[model samples]
Target: MASGNRPVLTVTGLKKSYRSAGEDIAVLRGVNLAVAAGESVALTGESGSGKSTLLHLIAGLDAADVGEIILDGVSLSELGDAGRAALRRDRLGLVFQQFNLIPSLTVADNLTFQSRIARRHDPKWQEELVERLGLARLLKRYPEQLSGGQQQRVAIGRALAPKPLLLLADEPTGNLDEDTADEVLALARDLVARTGCGFLLVTHSARLAATLDRQINLHAGVIA
Candidate 1:
């Protein structure tokens, strides 16, 4: 892990609810958490435990009903739509269970897409990611041309290409086999350490959760 004691992300007094059938369904209630630079955390929760809702709020995809999220010292509540969008583009790395690679682009292009658009592209760093992710020989292939594991690797590389301050993954390996999931996650953790970025992963696998530096379970709208 890189040297740093400062937290890359922090959540305080977070609360959210949704109205359903004339009733307000509470999701997250006063949830507080923090992820320090170079630290990896796993969030485990049953379905409807609000894991994805919390992530959406943190990523600025949706607004929290109450409380705040601080990303690299910038408060999410303070940012406008444009600001949030810009932050997401430039400072946050996000990966989902689905390997959302561009089908039209080759592996090299897919890997560099976000960095290039954000104007944060670093040739050296990009090369290092390609090498570390074992994607060098597959650079010429497109997303459909690769296997599930390979495509996921490319997705991870693309997310980390710009060296974001925080990485949020929602069941990133949900579609892969156990062995492949472990391998992919190992690569992700190694890269997170290399970048000194805070990592927050949501997974259902208790075994996978155990590999993280810390594990927290969400239950009944709060961290349990």
Candidate 2:
């Protein structure tokens, strides 16, 4: 783990709401959290508990109605749409339950896609990711040619290739079986540590949540 006291992510009094059938629905209210460098934090919440909403807000995919999100010393509210998009591309790594690997690209190309676009590709680091993720042998294979776990591993490698300041994953292992979920998550945690990047993982499985360095629950639109 990288030795640093400063947090890679900080959320303060974060709030968001939406209109539903003419009624206002609050998803997150006064939610405050932080993730330090090299730390892995698990976010567990019941369905519709705003877990995905918070993640979307953090990733700049959606805007928060109120509150503040500071990522790697930059505030989300300060950036415009294009700036936020650039930040997401350059400073944040995201993974979802679906293995969104490019079907036409080989594993090698898929792994380096994000980094290359971000202009932060490091050959040595990419090589290390290939070796660490056990993707060396599958480099020439396409996504369709790999198993679910293998494809997820490639997704993870793609996310980490740029060494972003923080990694946000939403139900990243939801589509996998127990053993495969555990294996993929273990690789993610190890790689997050290796990169010294803060990790915030949203998971429904309490068993999986307990494996992280810290765990937090969201309930009734607040951190409970």
Candidate 3:
């Protein structure tokens, strides 16, 4: 744990299970962790170690069967479905491997979409992110017009536009080649630092994990 630091995220005895067929599959078992503001933590695990499930729970997209997830001092269990959604929109930024951009919207529109929805739209910040992400030249181009790497860059720009308190990325560079992945991760790290937000990156690449401030490995759903 980092002393003298304000925690942006705190998880205590987090657990989750799923009903698969006739059996209950326990995914996470008593996992506890904390992430400090402006810190970057890399989470690595085997495919079925429940990495994505843990991320979903932390993101408020899914409920945990047991344990507490506190983000910025608010407990996720205390928030109703709508409240969680609002919290996510207002205080959290997420980037997925799929690069979920609006196909019909231009790059610029896609970039500022979430911030606009969250009512935290800052034109100056958005402009800076666009320039930093190299999306300034492709503002008018649709997602379909961009390559995979380009779309991912747009996705990163979109997540960063809101200046959220925490950013969650699930294998954000999974769709890119090694060289491009490194580039994108570097850009993400730089932006996260400039924004002064905490970051949790779920990845399998040891090389990539080494670049972060700390690495947390999940074994059978528990931090090892």
Candidate 4:
């Protein structure tokens, strides 16, 4: 729909497969994708179209049977597990539908975990984020102490704290009520824009995808 040449991520001939019931199931077949820096893109699909699989592959959480994934000019396939983990820790930000916050940590700790792991923790930026994400008052509260919406906000704060090269969101609003989902999604949009980070969102809602710069649907693992 729109055009840009920033090129933060690129994919070519991507493939993934799994074996089940003594049969080989091919989830992705030579998929190709490109995302520019500072852009927001929506990835949508129906049930079992391999949307999550693609997101996982792009995030370096899963391996591809073939092809390549290049992030910020570095090919992910070339990195070992430790290297990939480091890349994910340092250069990538991830937000999921479940809001995977650690139960033992307080809001502040959860928010700063990624940054600490990546060795990019900026105190000034963290404070601004606490206020901007509306997390200032909840800093001492743990994940169990917050509501679904509040917890999701904390998760978003954690992902953004690291200030990674790219943000990967998988059904980020799936667990919240419509109004709350709207609020969290809005916050995500605002922060991603403010930081000029690239976003690749996997969602089932066409309504949500419409707000992004481009919408690409995954069908049988191929972008349609």
Candidate 5:
């Protein structure tokens, strides 16, 4: 890792590959990225340019076949699956394009899910999250009872309630209408900024990417 109060996340020569039908498939090669504390960065790419792969690697949801990933001072290459899982639970938060809320859980329960996993539930924090995410009224309702926008808001609240060191978002607005997407992204950006955590969001929309602190493109397995 690089020294002295720099970025919370850094990558050098990050690579991922797979084998199918006796052929080697390289998804990402020699990608480099850096996201500092409280900074929002967008990863933009055409379909299959490896934007999602990069985010997964950074989040430790998937492994790199080779290369280095350092997040919040720890190298991902050095951690085992169990170690990485713990790190993700304790220090990372994720938002997916699909709002993966549990079907049976109420809004209140879903928002505090991470806290339960980490054994660190704070009722007050969850309450604050409910209000901030505009989920107070919906707290008693289930996922099926909410609209796409409301569901996404709950997803954001769940991710943010953990106070993670880094937040990874993968096409978070892909399913929403333009106005709703903008609104959800706006709330997400605002909360992440207020919490002072590093954020890396993947999107194909130039307009959305433009709203971030910095924007970079991925092309042919490399960051541009």
Candidate 6:
């Protein structure tokens, strides 16, 4: 690891580009980052600065043009598609701006969905998350019945339920009002601390970044 300590995640000389209008546009250029076990880091940058690209790369949703990603001491470059998929399923948790909840499932079911899929579901942890997220009252309701903030809480709950080693959040508060966003983030940080999981949060909110333990700013496809 970069710090000589075992980091939950580390990225080295990462690069990524996309083809647009018949020309290649670079999104990430020689980017490097790390998140220690149980530490929280905020990733901030303006639009098109590749904040989300870094998260996608770390999550193994997209491949980099060069460099390496190490998660929980495992190199992503060595993993095949199936291995990547398994890693994501068993060791990673994601919270996106979209709050990708199943519309058919009730709040209770949605909260436990990822954990069940990972086969690491703990009834006690699920109950605690439900209480912490203030979702106990909405358990029987479906996603369509909940407001945007409520759905987001459910999403956070789902991500944390599995107690994964690493959590990647991409603008998880994008759709909420400032106050609600703060509340949700508070819950997330608390749960992450409690679970002893490392967090890499991507956000445009400086105020939100301030709440984290450390902050990393990305500019022109590189850490600034």
TM-score of 3: 0.98
* Model 6 segments more than 4 A misplaced: 1-5
Tell me how many clashing residue pairs each candidate has: 0, 0, 0, 0, 0, 0
lDDT of each residue in 171-210, candidate 6, tens digit only: 9999999999999999999999999889999999999999
State, as a TM-score between 0 and 1, how close model 2 is to the true structure: 0.97
In lDDT terms, how accurate is model 1?
Answer: 0.94
Model 4, span 1-224: residue lDDT tens: 23655788899999999999999999998899888877899999899999899989988889999999999989999998888898899889999988899999999899999999889999998998888888889999999999999998888888989898889999989988989988888889889887777899988999889988899988877988
Query: Model 2: per-residue lDDT, tens digit, 59-112?
Result: 999999999999988999999999999999999999999989989999999999
Best by TM-score: 3
Q: What does candidate 5's lDDT look like per residue over 1-224, in tens digits? A: 12343698989898888898999989898898888888898999999999988888888889998789998789998999998999999888899999999999999899999978987777887777787788878989999999999999999989888888888999999999999999999999999888888889999999999999889999999987
Whole-model lDDT, model 5: 0.89
Candidate 5 stretches greater than 4 Å from native: 1-5
Using TM-score as the measure, name the better of candidate 5 and candidate 6.
6
Worst ten-residue run, lDDT, model 2? 1-10
For every candidate in turn, the CA RMSD to the true structure comes to 1.6, 1.5, 0.8, 1.2, 2.1, 1.6
| Candidate 2 clashes between residue pairs 3 or more apart in a chain or in different chains | none
Candidate 3 residue-wise lDDT at 211: 99
Cα shift from native, residue 41, model 1 (Å) = 0.4
Which portions of model 1 miss their true places by more than 4 Å? Answer: 1-4
User: Model 3, which residues run further than 4 Å from truth?
Assistant: 1-3
Residue 165 of model 4, lDDT score:
86
